[model samples]
Target: MRYFEFILILEIGILLLLSLFGKKLLNRRIVSAFVLVTLVAHYFLEGIRWQMYPTYLMAFFILLFYNHDFLRKRKWYIKTILIFCLLLLAVSGAVAKLVPVFDLPDTTSRYAVGTSNFTLEDSKRSNRKLNMKFWFPTSKIGSPDGVYSENPVQTLDGLFDMPGFVFGHLNRVETETYNNAEILNDSIKFPLVVYSHGAASSHLDNTGLLREIAGEGYVVLALDHDFSFSDYNLKKSDAMTLEYVAQKAFITDLIDKVVPNQVQDIEFILGNLPNSNYNLVDHINFEKIALMGHSLGGTTATDASFNVQGIQAIVNMDGPLNTASIEQLELPFLYMSSFSPDISDKSLEEKGLPDAMLYRRVKQWELENVYRLHDRNTIGFHWVRFRNAGHMDFTDVPFMLPIMKTDSYDEHKGHLLKSSVILDFIDIHLKNGKNYQKVKDQSLEWIK
Candidate 1:
């Protein structure tokens, strides 16, 4: 249990004991003051969460009743109310929040990180307003808000049509990235890595990798295409056509609409960064920009790589590109995948542990996408499929909840291993020229 939770449990115990004997201690100012002080301290310290209001009311009411001789009932009903309040107060703190802390990785360089958000118009898609998030290297580390998102459970609950508690403590996850840290002053230009999230996900979906990479002295920007609570349009899920699901009309709509919409979002970020008023723009080496994302966002990254002039590479995490126009693609690429389609079910029940339906979909998706990757005759692409990682393992969701993690490999180690591989690939293509064949041979299964 967390410090706050323990404190809450103790406070509830004291409150129950006090109400029964509060009348005896009423005239004693110090004891009365102590109880009242603890009550206010509890709420004020956490900054007055709305969830604590009921407990606050009950505690204060108990105090008022005990102090007033007329209202102080030595009756069964009074005891019942006190007992009820005590239980409610204790339970509130337990199920209230997780207050997650980021397990920040040690950096190779002395690093500083900063973030900035931009809202712009999506001209192609009815000029809808869009939001962008950025994480960049700074000269001196700055103080961060620590929170990555406000209420993730509610946002995803509505989208996935699942219970909110599936991701309980989702809102409590704190980010280690500093809020608008001072931009690095060095003259050497830094490579820019633009991040896109999976469909029905926000810019924060891959925050763990983004922060880790930013610590390695790269400028990372995670754009939020749909960062609102008002009925998220999950149309992007249809953006890529799986061989089994490609015949549906919605798949066509996905190709024509959602794919372009995401590609445009990446382009918009690239276009806006050159003249961006943010101090870090001076450090961005526009000629060495790259795009990466999970799932649908990966597809977007691949699409962006096609037209974007200065892009040095594209990193797609378990997401297949929707376009059949991969023949002419010249950009260097990094493709990471979960278990392939051919893996057996017995192996899956022990390793992946996803629901039966999800496992089926993943296998089929893998079959089609793997075929696509094979058909593309590109010297620049390096595809890696982890031995036993679940589909969510490529992203941060599994790491967020240890219980939910069913991947055969440990989530953190797997992610760290992947991040190291990614940094090496970027080092070779974007910054310094390095041989990746050795590292690739040992750590990854070379696909095609």
Candidate 2:
């Protein structure tokens, strides 16, 4: 909770206690003014959020009762009113705690971050328009309020199958990047990192990490795939349920189409980026381009490195290699995997679990796929496991909602470690940086 938010809640709680206990320790007029001033301060300082509406209304009612001398009646109704006000205060505090206005972590780089959005159309595929967003190093200096998205509530509502207002607080969240700012005009061109988002995720989902990469002097480009939340095509119940693998043939066919098409989209973007009017376009060094993605997009990146030429390296953030076409990867590959519980049939039986056969099959396939891919790539394969991470940890979801994180997950440190490792990996391969040993996190380890 923010400073003034906590203070307001505490003041309301104290006021309710004093009123309910028949204590006249403070002047009624003074109490009224105090609450009023606090309310105004909270509104102006923290901005108005819907979670505090009840608290505001209750404060007004309290001042009205005090000013009208209704509290002097000493009747049972007075106690009831005070109790109700206390309940409202609790509600306000709880909601405020649940939906906080979060701030993005600081970008650990010398360069300031700038971002811009653009769109591209693929004529070969019925002119399907792909939305793209890019982040790059900027010489501009200023900490302007950053936006999560122009309309994240609607997209997140559909993606999570929740009411739009559930994420309305996100509208107030701030990031660390400036929009449409001038890109850094250094004489040297920056290496480009092409990013692909996961299924049911948008291109800007990893904005916090992408901004850090850009701040570290790389141009990062990410795209919204056809399966992205804005254009989500798959039914969550059918594809995300425990019975997923039961429809293996159906889902596999869909992914087979999705991965290749997304790869084509990446290639198309890279091919046209040089001709584009973006300020970063002239400063991008296409010869040292790297491919990176999360979940299914990670698989797409790995697949694209083989099909596309002049790719320097690949970073697959917890993406299972279920649908990767080639068995061997010759390029520098970073496979970051999230922690998953072992779901063996014996363990399931011992734990009295239901027979979710399809779920078990899907997990088995993923484990095998990762092992096979890692084992086959004898050269330049780096694997790291994030101990307490969920699939969405690699993105900004954990930073947004407390419920999205595991009980043991350290959101701040986890992201910092992720950014550090990714930077180290890309720097070594793409920038040809020194190979000195660096500090490593115990939760994250090199598997190969």
Candidate 3:
């Protein structure tokens, strides 16, 4: 919770307790003035969120009921009001805790991050429109006042499967990237990292991570694939639930086409980068390009690495290699999977069960990549798992919608591990950068 928000809520709770147990000690005029002051401070300082509306209403209720001698003297009326206030407080607190303001960790690099969006039309594929954002190293000094996402309404609806109005306050969330800031123009050419979001996700899903990478002297090109922005409503449902089954067949059919289309999108963007007018492209080191993505996007990166030439490295964050022929991938590859020992057949033995079937395939696909990495010829390959982490833990979805959380690992800590590990991997492979013996994390277990 934010500073003034916590203070306001706590003060109200104290007032409620005093009304019940110590009404003689309660100062009605002083309490009313303090509540009004706190409410103003919370509104101006922390910002008002819909989740706290009930609590805000409760403050007004206290002003109406507590200040009135007739209502206060009637014990039954007071008890009824207290019960209603308790319900309101519970609802408000729960919602507030569930969807708290998601402030991303600060960028830890010397360079300030700069981001800009571009629309690319693919001539070969029916003039398919693709949106991409460039997060690049910037020489600009001031902190960014820009909002984190461009399409918060779409993000809330598509990513979290929630009504846009519930989290409309997210539109006010600030980020660390300056919009269209001047690209760092030092003589050194920056390594390019093309990032792809998970299926049914936005390029801005991992905005925090992309900014962190850009701050570390890399040009991070985040792609908004044609399928992710399509009319498909991909609910964030658990694999074990009936909701997933209802959507499974449709998702399967669409995803088969989605992966190939995304690979084409990546290829098109990479092929056209040099010819493009974006200034950030001029600083890109074409020779040192890396493909990185989450979920199905990670699959696309691996697939693209095989089909497209000049990709120096690949990073797949907890994405299954379902569509990718990983055996053909020859570049430096990093596969990061969430810790899921229960994915094994022994642990989840219901082989024919619909939920288990999907789980099995995902686990099998991840295992295939892990097995390939263990091969003697597969050099520059790393497989690591975040302990007690879930699939969406790699993305920003969990921060905004905690209901999506499936594991106990801290999301903030997981991000730090991801940023540092990816930075070290790309540095070593793309920039011939530092060599870490192992990325030191208690939860991040290195498996070969």
lDDT of 3 by residue, 370-441 (tens): 676566457788888876677788888777777776545577777788888888888888877666467886
State which candidate, 1 or 2, has the greater lDDT: 2
Ranking by lDDT: 2, 3, 1
lDDT of each: 0.65, 0.76, 0.75
TM-score-based ranking = 2, 3, 1
Residue 341's lDDT in candidate 1: 53
List candidate 1 stretches off by more than 4 Å.
Answer: 13-94, 97-109, 122-125, 141-146, 149-174, 227-256, 276-278, 340-347, 350-354, 375-377, 399-404, 407-409, 437-448
User: What is the C-alpha RMSD, rounded to one decimal, of candidate 3?
Assistant: 4.2
lDDT of 2 by residue, 1-448 (tens): 7787887788878877877887774787788888889888988877777788888887787677765556655799988888888998898888888777777786777788888888888788789888888888888876755577756666455444556576677767777778888889899999999889887667777888998899999999888874732243555556545565445654565467577778888888877768977666778888898999988889889888876766999999977675445465778888887754464556444433344355456656666767886668657777888866766788887777666665567888988998988998899878988872443778876676
How would you encode candidate 1's per-residue C-alpha lDDT over 195-258 as one tens digit per residue?
Answer: 8887656677677788778878788888876632233343434434343454244434444556
Cα displacement (Å) at residue 432, model 3: 2.7
TM per prediction? 0.76, 0.86, 0.84
lDDT of 2 at 369: 67
lDDT at 140, model 3: 84
**Most lDDT-accurate candidate:** 2
Better of 1 and 2 by TM-score: 2
